[model samples]
Target: MIQGDSVTETHQGILKLRVSSLIALLFVAAAASAGCSEKMGSAFAPSAVEGVVGGGQLQFHDADTTSTATQGIASGGKKARWDALPESEKAARKARMAQRKARWDALPESEKAARKARMAQRKSRWDALSESEKATKRAARKQRKARWDALSESEKAAKRAERKTRVRIAK
Candidate 1:
């Protein structure tokens, strides 16, 4: 009975080891791909500039980018779906990314550092906007609403009537 139990235990341990190795390989693949994405974008990289920006530089204002990174405006912005590409296309995408990276590298170090710092500060300020500031804005909004609500009934009626007339004329 002891020998039978020992044999089963060894078999299960080997099976566990194989599963762990497979999982480890998957993780390694994921990590390698993540690194590639920063440097090369995906196999379907639509914009070369984005791939370059995804790394350390943070490109936003370049003429060809999908959007102003700060304003969150993009020309082709299908933010949900990223991957799904053919291999030949992936090679082409990688070439495009290299070009973008080369252009970015040509800038003077001082300029590069300055731009990086400026963008960092901008991000910091955007992030650091306080709850107190938010509350103040809220209070201001409420004050405006309250003032609007305080209008005399006759004034409100006149505005509503004017709006209705304008709508009718526009239509």
Candidate 2:
């Protein structure tokens, strides 16, 4: 009777050890699968540079310098930048814009009319908003832009990947 009791205790101990080892192995496997470089918080966060012209290449400038640059562009007009570009670059840009315009022109008349109507409706709605409401909307836009600018490259990639996945699933 004493020998049987001892055997049972030893078996139970081994079973407990196996269970502990299995749990630890599972934890290690899960961590490995999650990738070492990804931060949990940023995995699904939106990128800070979504609509920027050069994407991740955006440069920061002091307020005065930025305003001056903006003023230069605005005052000089968009034509100035076009004039500064090399002839070959200008030709390529012109070709691209022409292609886009051609595509727009090729759209069905009803579709074009619908788009125009939608734009007019949107403009009317915006115009109807109170000054404070417009200010709030602008502030929200700025906050989103700031948040998008704050994301790291890896986080941005994660967000893009998530967006692609969502789009694919929706389709």
For each candidate in turn, give its C-alpha RMSD to the true structure in angstroms. 25.9, 29.6
TM for every model, in the order presented, reads 0.28, 0.40
lDDT of each prediction vs. the true structure?
0.57, 0.59
Report the C-alpha lDDT of model 2 over 1-171, residue by residue, as the tens digit: 246435576777878767755654554445446542223432222222222222222122332332111211342235567678999998999899999999998998899998899889899999799868987998999999899899999998999889887844320
Q: Write the per-residue lDDT of candidate 1 for residues 71-103, one digit (tens) a residue.
A: 123223433223456667778988999998998
Q: Please give the RMSD of candidate 2 to the true structure.
A: 29.6
Give the poorly placed runs of model 2, Cα more than 4 Å off.
Answer: 1-96, 152-171
lDDT of 1: 0.57
Model number with the top lDDT:
2
Q: Give Cα distance to truth, residue 140, candidate 2, Å.
A: 0.8
